[model samples]
Target: MATNTTTKKPAAAALAETAEARPERATRRAPAVVGPPLGEGQEPVTVTLSHHHRIDGTDYTPGAEITVSPDYARGLRGQGFVART
Candidate 1:
């Protein structure tokens, strides 16, 4: 009878090998807003909120009007957060 001999790799070494064999995963980023490009020197627009929301670290209640860049206001409008009026 012949005795069988085998060597087992350490758990950490196996994990490192597995990780290196795998391809690097791409980093996630915020989705880009799809709309017209912002114009230079474009006047800001005032929009009234239809719901309580926060902007630029400032809290705003429903019906509160805040002036922001036209492009930003357009985004809010599209989301139904800003009143149409």
Candidate 2:
């Protein structure tokens, strides 16, 4: 076998290079109130997004109504969603 001469990059430098190759991800803001949560002993409510938002790789356009559980709706509320009332 023939002799070869080569140099390896430092770990930090390699990481920096990889980081630069990836695009920055969009940042998310706190969810706003659109409507009140479901009433006591009531069924799931139909909710809509007040503004364009993205959650967990899913895009939710404004004015879109979706039937979701009260618990889930509450969670979505923090993610900028609101009930349709």
- lDDT values of the candidates? 0.74, 0.68
lDDT of 2 by residue, 1-85 (tens): 9866788899999999999998898796533423345567868756777877665455678887666657778787887667445
Off by over 4 Å in 2: 1-42, 54-58, 83-85
Question: Relative to the unseen true structure, what is the C-alpha lDDT of residue 59 in candidate 1, on a scale of 0 to 100?
Answer: 70
Backbone clashes counted, model 1: 0
Give the TM-score comparing model 1 with the true structure, all chains together: 0.52
Which candidate has the top score in TM-score?
Answer: 1
lDDT of 2: 0.68
lDDT of 2 at 7: 83
lDDT of 1: 0.74
Across 1-85, the per-residue lDDT of candidate 1 in tens digits comes to: 9876988899999999999999999995322322244479787677788998866455779997777768888789889999866
